[model samples]
Target: MNRNTPTSSKPVIAIREADYGRLTALAQVTIDKDLAVGDELMAELERATVIVGEVAACRTIQMGSTTTYKTGTSEPRTVTLVYPGEADIEANRISVLTPIGVALLGLSKGQSISWIARDGTTHTLKVVSVGK
Candidate 1:
């Protein structure tokens, strides 16, 4: 889907089944520390289409995938989606437990998602590219 495509109430997202269990567990673990983002991640996972195997050829974003994305009209940023323990903002490694990370997960290149921040601000994030 390109920028011109009309995004739905929530765009379709696909997640590898192999990552589902671990992701869900991660969300659960973070609930106490960050209820809002954790809940958001769980909700996103609940709505995702789980694929059983590899989708290496697809441009879908997954854990460990390096992606370039832009929020609203901001400049594009490259980040590696990683687990909380591995997250390092200075290195551009984002934790799936964060709002932007949850928003990026499962999205394919060219697709965009609107998410609410902890401070109650809404933002649109578009995936420019995805690389494993």
Candidate 2:
């Protein structure tokens, strides 16, 4: 059963069942810590449309997806959404444990959303494209 839900009032987001396992572990560990965005990450996960990996469809922003997005009016930038251990700001790889990274997951091309930074600053990002 592909859990591709259309969150009509909110932007549509989807996730693969395989990644769900690890993401849940991360959330379970982080949510109990102070100053972690784990709660937010958990919320995003809860709303995701879960599907089997093989037939999860195309263009869904799962881990390892190289995505191009714009933050508010800033110039567009591209980054590969990765796990915390693989994140390197200079290399443009973002960790899914981060606020923005968590927000970007399960999103498709042309979707937009506002995410809160660790410092409490809010930023709006629009996904321009998704690439494998």
Candidate 3:
């Protein structure tokens, strides 16, 4: 069987055209943060392939998508990606400006990304499923 490789091997990503504008603004928000991951988020946005929302894959991750993902070998977690204004750690709603959020945007099911955390520790998250 042929399995999709980790996201590290596929540097390109697709974002719904419907989301492009909002996400672009959100990306700017990250840049304003001036944090280490800010530039990385902007880079991801700049390189994304914008697709029309109606034709976009249902499995593609996006804002408001409730996704199940596994970080490293740990148990998979479910979180709803949201705008920064709606972020609440206890509610499991992560902000678009966060590191995990940046890595998760535009990814699809079965894909995964390895990135560095704010603490400089490395982490890998694989997309198990995406739901609205």
Candidate 4:
């Protein structure tokens, strides 16, 4: 298969149309700072199905959405998704540029995503809930 193909192992994700442009710009700028994660984020965005004209009704994880997710058998953690400048671990705000944030983006409740950590270990995160 080609490089950009979405393999069956990767779940299809949905992104809001309004967020697409900004996200693309973010991903592009991130490449200079972190190649692996930046490329991965760009790929994810490229393959996502864009939701149009239904921003308020979307249940998928997006910027500013508070999400609860679990990894492995660990307890779920709740965090608010935010831009890089706004991230504060103490505040439970996660930056979309981070691996966990990228994995959680565009996912709805019960959706799971697999991502490679900066350490190169593979991990999976399952979305338990999403709240605005």
Candidate 5:
């Protein structure tokens, strides 16, 4: 996905059947209230171009030239998002299973969010752009 353009309009979120089921099960087990919002979120995830979660949460992510500027860092880094099986950090390409990968899922361009790193430090990032 291209991470240069702004995502102003809300696009559809997509999710795999298995992933949807897993999320639903998790919500059901944890929350007592009716998971209507969670259900709707899953439906929306089906059409999502971006997703947000931990590294282990994503099944796949689009690969392309995208730049990321860390929340408190000045230098912007470019990286490619590859499928889980093809991710290589040394090449500046990462799998969707990585920390930054999952946190970026389902997010639109211009949206800023935070996620905890493996070291327990909070990391914030912004969606600079997204493309399929």
Candidate 6:
């Protein structure tokens, strides 16, 4: 991704009222501080384009080359951000609250972004495409 690339000018996609409500509830339950990044993220969730992918309908999503999260206390493992409710990562389906998921939200096909991981690592990811 080019550092000089221009930010998107397309109108933000609007999420459904039910989806927005669900995201807001999740944020309130999981987020720590009222001013934390999660707070900001939840506020923007209403404008995100929800993507979903499965084995039958794969959508490539860039993920941290080296990063992991707690999953049954076995070992930290890398995670891939795919559409919500799909793409199992470490046996746990990732939610958009995840760093990569949040970053990828609302992006169109071929759009690339350099995002900071939860562990402070930076990664470049492109939206290859989205599917049902």
TM-score of each: 0.87, 0.87, 0.85, 0.88, 0.50, 0.50
RMSD in angstroms, all models? 4.9, 5.0, 5.5, 2.8, 10.2, 9.2
lDDT of 1 by residue, 21-49 (tens): 99998888877675777778877887888
- lDDT digits (tens) for residues 1-132 of candidate 6: 212113353234334333456666766665655424475356456445554433322332322112233223345434454444565667544556666566554444455555556676766655545433
In candidate 5 the C-alpha lDDT for residue 8 amounts to 39
lDDT of 4: 0.82
Best by TM-score: 4
Q: What are the Cα lDDT values of the candidates?
A: 0.82, 0.81, 0.76, 0.82, 0.48, 0.47
Q: List the residue pairs that clash in candidate 2.
A: none
Flag regions of model 5 displaced more than 4 Å: 1-67
Write down the TM-score for model 5. 0.50
Q: List runs of model 6 lying over 4 Å from the truth.
A: 1-14, 33-37, 46-87
Rank ordering of all candidates by lDDT, starting from the highest = 1, 4, 2, 3, 5, 6
Task: Give me candidate 6's TM-score against the actual structure.
Answer: 0.50
**Candidate 3, pairs of clashing residues:** none
Locate the minimum summed-lDDT window of 10 residues in model 5. Answer: 1-10
Position 6, candidate 3: lDDT: 39
Instruction: Give per-residue CA lDDT, model 2, range 1-132, as digits (tens).
Output: 111223354587898888988998898788767436677677778888888855463587888889999997799999999999999999999999888888899988899887767777777888999888
Between candidates 1 and 6, name the one with more favorable TM-score. 1
Question: What TM-score does prediction 4 earn?
Answer: 0.88
For each of the candidates, give the backbone clash count: 0, 0, 0, 0, 21, 0
Give one digit per residue, the lDDT tens place, for model 5 in 9-118. Answer: 33333344445555445434423454233333333344454334534223332333244534666565656765556778899776544456645555555666555555
Better of 1 and 4 by TM-score: 4
Screening candidate 6 with a backbone cut-off below 3 angstroms (N, C-alpha, C), the clashing residue pairs are none
